[model samples]
Target: MQPFWNFPATAGGTINSINNAGIETFRGNELDSLTREICQNSLDAVKDEEQPVIVEFKQFQISRNQFPQRDELVNAFNKCESTWKSKNTKIEQFVEQAKYILKNDQIPFLRISDFNTKGLEGARTGELGTPWSSLVREAGSSNKGDSSGGSFGIGKSAPFANSKLRTLFYSSYDITDYQSHIGVANIMSFEERPGFNTLGTGYFTDSHNSTAISNLLNLDPSFQRDETGTDIYVTAFEPKENWVEAIRNSVIYNFFITIWQDKLVVKIEDETISHENIGTLISKLDDDKEEYCQVKAYFKLLTSEEGIQVPYPAKRYKKIGEFKEGEATLYIMKGEDLNRRVLMTRKAGMRLFEQNRISGSISFTGILIIHGTHMNQVFKKMENPAHTEWEPNRYEEAPSEAKKAFSDLRKFIRETVQQQFQAETTETMDAFGVSDFLPDTTQVAGEGDEKKESLTMKIKSIAHKKKEKPKKKVKKKQQKENFEDTLEEVGITPEGDQAGHSNDDRNEGEGLGGGTGNQQGEQGPADEGTGGAKEGKGEKEKNKPIDVDTRYICLEKDSGLYRLNIKPEKKFEKGKLEFKVSGEQSDYILPVITVTSNDIEITSIDKNVVRFVNLTGKKPKNIQVQVDYEQYCVLEVDLYEI
Candidate 1:
């Protein structure tokens, strides 16, 4: 039997009166709800499982009546003369379809047992969570989860601000008891009842491994839950044009605070990343508050090959005030233990990779001053519950209080991140080793000495006393003859008593008493025969001066080596080196050079009035001159050879 097609009544009509029946407004609050849910699952999995959490995204195309074409849409717009007559069928239908997808499709899709596996539930021993809890299971508070960042309860609706489509999330969790899976399904649409936006829970699923589960795998094998971990799935991940990085960064930033403290291993794909430690972000109580508050600036060394001798003092507290020009209020804290803590900073500036001032997360920790404290806030919105958290009123107000907090926190964090990023970039360009990029951490002077002193005191207290008194010596004529024979064999003069001699000969005619002593008669007081003074003088000569300069430039200086060529048409008297150029600048001429006592005495300078000055004041005895014409102009003076 064949089916017959039914035609619409207005199929042949102009249809000039179709009205726009969908919603027109969008709010970010809804997206926040969705973000909270996603973050909650990630934090839970990380805290409960291992590293490399996997998130899965699934998209289901909505089924709806085919909408009108572009020409029809344009005709409809052109025919309308006023607001009362104007029709917006395209946008209106899209909104309606979006709403329908959320309610009918997405909500139902996530509830399937195959999608929401039992691995997580079983592993957790039914210690699962709903939408409102923190991941930490403390004594007083619940171990389930918390809604701090996802506080507003509107996070589920957050996605609507980005798209009007079916959104689904699937996650797999690894636990000791058993691995588990959780799925979240939602539809974003306009509710006709109140003419407002809403999110509907479309579906949920949970189960143990089975054929049904294998069919739902959407992630790479690396992301598959082989061990204890979690996977997040979002089907139809409709990302805005420029929001990909923002959303990813937001997720990562929030993830650190929520789960980083729990010692969970984290990764985006294969690359391992961690949060800056809390202890490294704060200053010590004994530290100079003024210096701690001062903005610290330095280029961070990058690359595994280059090494930097970092001299920055470590801090132990978070500083919140700007103590210098062009620097923001920098905060430092030790997020974790000494080894785990990282120093982080936010900066603002442009670079080749970044079009504008690029901002994100940078690791800065592991310093001495931050020996205490364990709450580090480096990335934007990652810390500060007032900012990262969403509030209900935030959606309705233009400059919402929560949003203002976010902005402020964002500014603070951006600077820190920028600074770190620049440091990394600089290190990369300079090809410095990773070791030298360490933050300047303050050290406790004499800490080692104190420990050593304590140990010495302990040893002295445990040691035994010395023996009583020494025995008297007996001299023999045969012993003297043997000593003389030994000296003669070794080619030394028997010395009229110099070899195997008596106390008189040892004293060498000095007077032990008021009167001079002879070779006999007890040798006066025995002190005159000894040559102790001469031996002391000989020992002093062993430490005589040797020609050596302690100052020398090695690979470290060469690591950041850069040459700037300056040429002067005419030589000038002693003054600061300055020059001007004009027209098609082609060739570079070596500049006339001058040096004062303050300037490091260079080992060598170019003869054409060009000389290299070492600002470090390290005088060298030799120098090597070089010119790189291809670099446009660069006058290099080798200080090592000098």
Candidate 2:
């Protein structure tokens, strides 16, 4: 049968207008929304298991005559305008603009075509769960796989939002050789004739059942979905000036993992984002924003051959919520200018959100790739409509499990961050003193002899003018060494604030690769096919002293000596180095027998503090610290200003 525009009669039902909350959900972000949603849906519709699905976005202008039934749509717009001319401003304004856009002799269309996937099937039986019906005949509904990137089904509205005329055309040729096509217009309620009103939602199909056209509808010459896939034609496309770059960034931002894993490839205009060019694309995103930087970091983690794999049944926590089941890999790297948040992403490779539950005061970036069937099934339920955040309450199946899972995820993130970097600078100063962690110089015998040449010299250095930014507060109770608040009061701020900076130069991605060679394999063995044990809420978390980036610590064999090699990031004047020894279940100050430095001029050696002068940034300064204990145990050192 021939096709025509169909807006079913309301038949004295509740009147509707142009205020579509689903369409409005993507306001001001039409292009980004479209890119994210369209790509996510394609990822879910994967047909071949071994190959990647490809999505191509091509926009071109065609003469208005090329689009069939153009006059009929224009007539509908006229009726819509006349019916709500002065009755509703929003409807009136929308109709006026849509009518104006329709009057152009040359109409613009953005034809998005996808390949290497099953097309919109199930149209033959007109079934409810078919791809054709789910995408065309239905709204706010979906039947994707367990690990699909999308869940809310609201993503379908984003395409309409990109169209100035609020119209969209969907056509597909399924793997079964079945073909079907349909068009939908979301305008306002209007009167087709006297005393007869039609629905605001209109479809280009048979009036009786809204069945799609069985034959393929060629809307544009530049597009032809000859393969088993779907094509979305966004009419009256009003793309932004930087729409190309924006779309490129959005594709990478949302599906970097899929692209990097050879599961998805996106072609925009002349640029292709696949496993081959994925690295280069990620590099270009270095200057975009924090979110983009996160994308760059995530891409680096996914491509890198190293990271920690935390497997199912996370059984470490006692008080904190623990994961009873899941599959995930975590990669954390400490460096300059890292935003210090965990990138939580699903198997679909789309980033659900950046987690900042409790990062503590350590500068690092973490990526948690939650994959596998059981994990994705649980995690996807908590995802919001936009696939941006994890909303535990959104889980209708089991709210409690989802909430606990979310909490456990945060705990795991926080604990891993704390374990990787000694986030706790020192013990609570209220209960301890600096002298408690340091040895008494009067009790040592060599103190009287080294005092002859010790002369206190005042060090001169450049005074910084910028105000220091305070570190974030995190409450954690892991027992360890008691270094007190010395570093907290006089710690080095070598390079001013690092926020709003670039990390592309750090090459921080080196040690972050997972499932390969690493010096940290000896930490603790983990479940098969996963990373090792991370210390948190245990002994590993204790004795975590702040590590000075420019300093290195080592203990000599058959000697009571701990050598500290210091090379400041920026120049420093005069400072004191504190050395402490490991205590059973707790840490106390190791009594210093003697303090000596090769290049530094020692002003005085009091207890554990080695006050020195002229510690230049020109070269490394070697300081040999002598203690009474000969046996080697875990040791920690910190640098403080005099």
Candidate 3:
């Protein structure tokens, strides 16, 4: 045998004194979160279950201590008859029933697409905390089907919270050959205060109702029977108002709609809400296909100017119809059902202010597909981020991956919003109706550099084209001379040149100098007589004027009659040109000096000289331009421009 080598492991004996640092206790909403975790487990376990799982919702009474309203009821119902007592006893019965159903039931109701079953093979159970009460969530696992977000039991809370009275469930599964058994569990909600905290531990518990139905079947020899399952029923649950069919639809739109695929089927009450089926949901992303992106937006309503400066940082409310602008309230939903899980639009549009309300906020939640590809920014103007709310979810502290994804997605969303509103606004303005309102903020705020560049280029082209001088008019006499030169070379001449013509006929092209020696000798007599002396001086001066290369460094202030300034350059020249001025650097230009009188004309001309008089009866503001260097200009602009 080989010799054994062992080293003692270090240990601390003060178990009671040492703090419990390694473990975190689940509490409050934590339990509900854990239920969600367990629901996932059950959904994964049903890979080969013989039958589909079923989900049911039912309501029972709550225990006096756990119920938020129990004490009030106990005081009122202290005295009662035998039958009344039997019917009303205490709230404990329901709590025990709910617990028993979760612990003992072999199969739990499973939710599978629109065709939910009583229960499926491999049932799982868990518990969670609600705002008002605690709930036990049960679900059946799936072996070969689409996954569910609600499988974690948090989904089950949706129906319970929204329901009014009763919920039900019925499930069946076969554990032995030719033997079938069916089980049923029901759920409901009750109000309770002083509930659990972040850790799942709480004094409040669920008010629930549960029962199991079992039997033996498979009588017909030709018939094939499969695995075991359970059933559930949610009765007396309140469906959302007229516009919304049910809470499930709202859930679909808010969270799960984006996952719609061939394999997943969703419904609103009895109405099928989504387009994609369960099969499509199960397929993995195609290698060549671009991944989906998450949408984020932070929004607020503004009635006052102050609101404009404060950035809104609030989450989307789960319930619809909570925002009231005036007499009407706006509702958000996907398709018809408001509760169904569905995808969010990149940019959402609404006639927000028309109905009297000023603004609203919305945020999107989903898994986004991203790659190394960089996203280009789209804004109303290259410099503006205020025009649109891009990332539906932006926070002060966020993960790097999330930050990058949101940055790209925000640009796309902002661009889309701008385009949509711009097109609509143009179409609308062209039509007959007048809109006495401001344009939607989302469309106008965010514009990127691309748009600004295109605009700048167009403006520059127009400016350049305008600067070109017009072409000079050519004379017919010059044309005729050129023509005669070509004709002589080709040995051809006009009839008038070859023969002879009357004075009237000859005068038609007289200035052309087509005649022979006598006329050629006198050709300059008419031009010389018209203006002989004036031409020589102009020709000499056009070639050279003394160049003045002085730069202006001066300031001006308004005066009663004329303007005053410290002139640092020569008087203006007719050929003076100004440099380009852009919005970004427009402030470089010095403040204009207002003219006080119309008589403001330079009475004296000298370097650093300015003198004028108010000839007009009424004095007007005098105006003058001041010149400064780049450093001076930068210092003069308003604080906001920086």
Candidate 4:
């Protein structure tokens, strides 16, 4: 049989290391690695066609008698040393376990097949462009074109790692020549014996002719279907229970973009899963409700034409210094339910940067598809072996043309994504009124104190006019000094009045006499005395003692709507001023309140008071109120201490 791991070694040394070296590159669960790797390989093998690539996953049981070349494999295991000369316990145990598994009448196998694609075809010399040799003989060799989805062939080890016996079979139908080829590989540990010692890895084919298999058509009847495709049979599949669901979820999670593009289709057993019925599949996968909704929203955005266009510069031709314009579509969604990430994809429909976490709790989830020939080329070169991220080191290691193009593209993507992230964060903050939470530190100087004094004088003049007789006018300077001195005596600085004055004061001054103007008339001396006493009393009421206690309220920043929370620091009588609110929506700002509250006192345009109703005959320490506003506007409620 043909042995790919036939590396030469000296005496008392390993002939070849057949363990899972490349398989360790996969970080998470085995099913995720398997789905990502296999699908990428299938995508890379797609021929030019309008039809999408179809992949199927199925499981079956095979008896020892049904295994192709079972006798040869059994003989090889029996002849190999149970333990290597170096005394490796894992090798000895693996050999014994494999022997036991092969002796059994029933064994589980997982078969993954793909249709409507170019099969592994070419010469058997392991050349750069030969798929047949590349699949069998090469470990990390790949010659895929720039638009291909996969670049590293090492992903082939994933299936082998999932198999308990570390054995898998490959069968492909070459469309160009209409010929079928089958090969099997078993990965074992290093072992040594007299005259029969070899590498732990070998193929199940004729020893005399390495390229021939025994009765390939009889091994599996599907091999004679006259279709150009590839089938992989993983023998002794481990963790057999619930494997179908695991694989289905992994496929959906990683390749959903491909499915959305109508470039790929997948099936597990009798059920066909695609983008059209992804909701049902998501339900079956037992995904979180928020995750399900976010995924659904993501697909909607991807399919619809609702995204921002981001344009950047790209290399034009072979000229040393020339660039052309290119554009990419960027879609962003903000919420706590969405996954916080930025998926970078190319025209081939392969996603990159799957593990990157964008810096924010805003949960910005979206994709940036960089289009155009020059841009795609630059991004494709940045992919590493695992196809998970775009490394910056590519720019420094590549040639001058690629180096410049990739550097520019990398910088463009970073800057564009950062700009979009910052913009979204700012928009979210504005929408949620985050800026209002900050402490107001603006110093109240000349103009502010003057404005406060002028407002106080206007209120007094309006109150006096409400009386029957007109009172003598006070000097503007004297009034201003008196107002400033009164504020200081009441433990409030002139600057403090300008900064901490509630909406009540401002509204009262603007709407003097509460929209009730005084009537002109003549009065007797008794009425005059009464009017003078009432005017003096109104002046005292204008400068009434207002106890100020301020507490910053924290709102839920995840959702669009925020419920107002109030925590008063002092107890109040029934008629005493409770609190005054600022930052309420204004009519000029496209009033978001479609329906006003029933209470006119609370919903009035001038000054509003939020009253609490005790339903259980108990007083609540704090109150929560919901404010309805337009989806785009921020609603912040500031509760002033009475």
Ranking by lDDT: 2, 4, 1, 3
In terms of lDDT, the poorest run of 10 residues in model 3 is 350-359
Candidate 2: list runs displaced more than 4 Å. 286-288, 312-326, 423-642
Candidate with more favorable, higher lDDT: 1 or 3:
1
Model number with the top TM-score: 2
Q: How well does candidate 4 match the true structure in TM-score terms?
A: 0.60
Residue 64 lDDT, candidate 4, scale 0-100: 90
Q: In angstroms, how far off is 112's CA in candidate 3?
A: 10
Models 1 onward score TM values of: 0.28, 0.65, 0.25, 0.60
Error of 2 at 430 (Å): 24
State the C-alpha lDDT per candidate.
0.28, 0.69, 0.24, 0.53
Candidate 2 per-residue lDDT over residues 1-642, each given as its tens digit:
667888888889867788788899999998889998988888888899799999999888888877757788989988988888778998878878877877888899998989988988886767897777788777788888888887667899999999988899888888899988888988778998988999788888864678777877777776666788888889999876688888998888877877888989899988898999888878877674667777776666555555454543454333322444657777777766566777788888877778763443456777788776767777788888988888888777768767777786677776666666643546556655767865444645656665444448887987879977556333333332333443244442222211121112122211110011111211111111111112232322111112243322334534776654554443556655555543564444665678777678887664554556754654667667787677764554445433
For each of the candidates, the C-alpha root-mean-square deviation to the true structure, in angstroms, is 27.9, 19.6, 29.5, 18.2
lDDT of 4 by residue, 1-642 (tens): 442323122365455444457755653467778887888888878875588888888777888988866766766566454435246666567667888888999887878888888877763332455886777666687777666766677787788777777777777766664444455554543334454445566665544334534222334434344577778888887664487777777776677778877888888888787768765665454445554454565665565564445666545546334445654555655544555555677766665664232333234566767666555555666678777777645644445666566455545544554566443323333357866976555657755543342223334443335545455332222222233244355453211221232221222111101110011122111111011112333432111222322222213233322222222333443211222222343111111121122221232221122322222221222332333332333232322211
C-alpha lDDT of residue 575 in model 4: 11
Candidate 3 stretches with Cα past 4 Å from truth are: 1-153, 166-231, 238-240, 243-260, 267-270, 273-642
Per-residue lDDT of candidate 3, residues 1-642 (tens digit): 111111111132211110111111222222232222222323333334343322212223222232222233232212112113344334235334433333332312222221322233322222123201112222322122222222122333333332222122223342322222221112211222222111111111121222122333221223233544322333222233432222232223232323232222234334443434322322322323322111111111111122112111222222211211121111222111111111222111110011110111112111111111111111101211111133323322333434454443334433322232222323333534444453433433478544432223334443335555434322222222233354466553222111111221221111111111111111111011111112334521111111222122113212211112111122222211111112252211232222222434433221111223323323222334332223222111100000
How far off is model 1, as Cα RMSD?
27.9
Provide the global lDDT of candidate 1 against the true structure: 0.28
lDDT of 1 by residue, 1-642 (tens): 111111112223333222211112224333333443444434433432333333333333422222112123222222222222224555456445544443443221111111121234332433334211222111112233222222322333333334443333334443333443333323222221333222222223223211012123333332344443344443334554433334333343333332233332233332333434312322221234322222111111111122122223232222321222222333333221111122332221100010112111222322111111121112222322223322324334332443543344344434443444333323334456865865545557866543332223334456678976534232211222333354455454311111111121112111111111122221111011121112333431111111112111111122222222222222222212111111143212333343233333343232232223344332222222232222322222211111
